[model samples]
Target: MRLNLRTIWKMIRELSGDDAYERYLKNFHKLHAHDEQHECDTPLSKAEFFKQWQDEKWQGIKRCC
Candidate 1:
């Protein structure tokens, strides 16, 4: 699946309705900051970043039928 900024923002908006989303965003920002630090200073690959975010944000959320 391909993800662009629009898709990401859509997901963020949807997830933001949850209380835990704030915590997830905080952790994600921390991870982004740490990634920005350090000597390597390499940016996260799109897939890697999205995978990490999905795990952090939606791992336990279940969809209702």
Candidate 2:
């Protein structure tokens, strides 16, 4: 058997919503990175982002069939 890392990463990103976080980070930096006094490169680290993501996810309807 061969391990398909690309496919595995895609599935993990979809399930964990990491791809969204990455997109958010990209947009955040693009809009805010110009500030010379910016205190941080990222508004939220992976841990904080994941916690908030989970909270928002379960706080309301996630999906419906």
Candidate 3:
């Protein structure tokens, strides 16, 4: 699917509610933890990298809202 930032953000807000953004932040932290545990030195683990990317992007939207 082709999802722009605005569309993704709106979907998250609608489906997960305002707290959904918080969940993303939490997932970011979790991904950070996973990265650390594996000594990945990246923002996320291979399995979670995409999710982390999306979450971080959504987080920016949450901050603005």
Query: All candidates' lDDT scores?
Result: 0.61, 0.79, 0.59
| Tens digit of per-residue lDDT, candidate 3, span 1-65 | 45688788887776755545456557767777755546544334444654655566675445543
By TM-score, the better pick of 2 and 3 is 2
What shift in Å separates residue 5 of candidate 3 from its native position after superposition? 34
Model 1, global lDDT:
0.61
Return the candidate ranking by TM-score, descending. Answer: 2, 1, 3
Please report the TM-score between candidate 3 and the true structure.
0.29
Candidate with maximal TM-score: 2
Sorted by lDDT (best first), the order is 2, 1, 3
What range of 10 consecutive residues in model 1 has the weakest lDDT sum?
17-26
Question: Per-residue alpha-carbon lDDT of model 2 for 1-65, expressed as tens digits?
Answer: 14688889888997877687787788788888788786764479877887887788897776899
TM agreement with the true structure for every prediction: 0.32, 0.51, 0.29
Give the distance in Å from residue 57's predicted Cα in candidate 3 to where it truly belongs: 14
> Mind giving the per-residue lDDT tens digits that candidate 1 earns over 14-51?
66643344555566567777565455444555566656
Clash count list over all predictions? 0, 0, 0
How far is 24's C-alpha from truth in model 3 (Å)?
A: 0.3
Q: For candidate 3, list the clashing residue pairs, or say none.
A: none
